[model samples]
Target: MTIETETGSPEAPPKTRLHVDEPLAAGATVGLDHERAHYLRHVLRLDRGDRVALFNGRDGEWSARIDGFGKGWCSLAVDRQRRPQAPEPDLWLLFAPIKRTRIDFVAEKAAELGASVVWPVLTRHTDVARVNVDRLRANAIEAAEQCERLTVPDLREPAKLDQVTRDWSSDRTILLCAEAGPVKPIAAAVAGLKPGPVAILTGPEGGFAKDELDGLLKLPFVVPVGLGPRILRADTAALAALACWQALAGDWATGGADARPPFRSQEPG
Candidate 1:
């Protein structure tokens, strides 16, 4: 199944609805969880027998009928599955969280800009010790649904910067955004890099310590880059890097053809 965008339109055509939790299966009895039920019943004001489009990260999207509503459960009977869409590239965005509101903005934009994964790293200059994974997931879900994306970017549990880089893969390029120092332009750094997998690392609010910078720079595949002459906030740096990546190496230039890459499995069964 292929998720193709209508040709000849600069804007993304609207998708009727988006389902992320579970793929709609034909003749399969699927129940909406409590939160979803509230959203379907109250927020959306959707009633029984209404039609909604659903996509469960793995399955191609499908049209579903609201089977019934009673108690706390809302049932849906999936009918036909739409053509599957390509997932995002094997690109990941690893950065420290900014303030609460700005962090939320980053997650949302990352989803729209087509990041394969989002990693929240705790660096020496990080503002928050911990992050709300659930909130970030919600933001990603909404972004995917609204952007006509068939697959949602995976939001990994927050980890310390040191721990994440300890086992970093040599095949994947790591684009590190340095705020105060001169570095290669993002385009130059990404040029001709292998397309298999990549990551963008941005510093926190106050920026990285000299020691932290040295640690990252010592890594075999880390490529430090500058956003521009002016300083940007943590959130701005993240989104700018993502936009540059997508425009240069992502499917954004190809319409929706490159939007969906192969989906990444969460864990081994």
Candidate 2:
């Protein structure tokens, strides 16, 4: 088996990128599971010798060629590294779980928007009793694949808001999206935040209870921030806060290491 060299070319990258748990290195053989194998063979109709991209959280993205395929299984030969592993924003998103579809949307968008962690928080006003962490992880994985993210957001088990707050680390600031009470506008608040580990917390559709809000405000790490005068849905608030943070203080801002043009402009010639 021959190992290819990295070219750092301006051409477009492979469209099919998959996240796997195995290590990625030159000449390494990666085997796809049944679901992914089915996706490539039946759904994508890709054949042997075709190319795809693979990445694990530890290794950077790599180009790989289909070496062989069969029923419910496929193997790829790692060709070369494309992009080096780069630093990403250490931002977490904690929110009160909502309905199924909307929560799925939150998981997907959070991964795309550079959230390092996605945790479901149970609040007094939260209506949803159960959270499907596996489903959230799947959505995060799919979103990371589509957005060219090197790693998917870590999906945490559902925990009560009070318990999470009690055990929270003081070094990481929490920007709580408050619907009422004295709060600084999101834009203004994020602008003053120092670069470090941070998290965005959003309430459920019904909003946080008065006692819950009061409890959070008392915490030294919590900073209440308002979206606007108008009320936003649970999912909307979470994504909005995430986007604002990324734009203002996260990796989306100017002078970041991973700054680049949109994916379409880099298409292969």
Candidate 3:
């Protein structure tokens, strides 16, 4: 994708970035084709000679100057790599879909929160039976581009709980936010676990089924945890779990949360 920078004017233009599916390299003539060109030229009112930033999941972010635009084609001269790929944790978000909009929100937020992967789990009580992987991927790409994230979170295809859980590794602790009553708060559970690779799982609108919860609980690596006294929506629970994990064992504490340009996080307490 290519973006148009503002013309020579007194006002500072809004910062715009575009996500392209190609490797970005400094000092290269990057070309935009078809849909992206139209969006930049027509929708965004970007003209030839405008400046915009381009970033792919690899090669980081780069500055580019638009040379021309027309006939479903846009050209730009890549200047420099504006941002470098930063370190991101192995944190993953494994959640059951709630509804259309809510599920979309969860996918976008997971990308913004620095989750390396977003795994949509088909739980016993999950309401949504279908997921458009392409739609989720688009949402993630947009989120990463806007948020200046060099690395886009991988939105894995939705998998059944049993099938996915059976291959679980004991090395990575999986925190399942079971809505069941006895589970301890996530903060407490996280504090007790040895820090390394971590992932959080949130259930659907009706919560996890007893048999499903029982199976997950029986896993040696799965830690059944609670979010607090209040029951959260699937999306909210997923984001809250991410924040809590980042705060405790992730990167929110180190102030790395805002230090890196593309990704990475702050220190955890």
Candidate 4:
């Protein structure tokens, strides 16, 4: 690690990632707003002509040079493609909201662990009844930028659990972290699934109501899975389930030129 100030706390220079909302191409010029300009200029202490990374989700990551700066904006000259646009695999996380911090945890971890979409659903036993979609979206963006992910997970409006279950896609498998009943080991369940779309369901700490559990279990596409003998917090269960699925059937299971993932989380907490 690079020394922060020799005598100061240890810190390396940040990766200099900026998520632009415009179409990016080689040799294109992109504008940065005041807030981002402030971040790059003051927070990151970047100077003119310094190199930075930029991505717009649709376009691939690019290495850019700070072209110029003004009162409220900064211009960047796109240099070259850093990483090609490769979206996360089709894995959706449908979770019930818990406490504020834990829900934030779910959003951050879901993006870091490769959730293509994050859907907040309201289950019968859920304690927290509301969600701040914008906050969740910001958390997703920060996580994506920090983790070097090409795209941020799509954040959806909160929906009722029953309605979500009713309109569920027939092609995608639903892996539910069950509150009770005969539960298949999560690892085994994920490992057995053929390559396809997936949606993992994790409810609030209070767990789903009897009727909700019963209805979900009855669905032909639903598969009740267990984490372990001990019950986990709502957020913990979601993380465990996501990691298990990725290792068994998702990108974590891919092998080619390199079995390692292209992205890495370099930002500190």
Each candidate's lDDT (Cα)?
A: 0.78, 0.88, 0.80, 0.84
Query: Would you list the rank order by lDDT, best first?
Result: 2, 4, 3, 1
Instruction: Please provide, for model 4 over 1-269, each residue's C-alpha lDDT reduced to its tens digit, 9 standing for 90 to 100.
Output: 35332235543433478788988998899999898898888887788877778888898887788889877889999866766787568999999998999999999999999999999999988888579999999999899888777888999999999999889878899999986997899988887787789999999898989888989999989989999999899999999999999888888877632622233345554
Off by over 4 Å in 2: 1-5, 8-13, 255-269
Answer with 1 or 2, whichever has the higher lDDT: 2
The model with the greatest TM-score is 2
Model 4 spans with C-alpha error above 4 angstroms: 1-14, 255-269
Q: What is the lDDT of candidate 1?
A: 0.78
| Runs in model 3 lying further than 4 Å from the true structure | 1-14, 257-269
Across residues 1-269, which tens digit of lDDT does each residue of candidate 2 receive? 12233464444445488999999999899999999999998898888987788889889888899999999899999877777787889999999999999999999999999999999999998999789999999999999988888888999999999999999999999999999988999999988887679999999999999999999999989999999988999999999999999988887787654453233334343
Error of 3 at 173 (Å): 1.3
| lDDT, candidate 1, 82-150, per-residue tens | 556545577899989877898899999999888889989999988696699899988988898877677
lDDT of 2 at 27: 89
RMSD, candidate 1, Å: 7.6
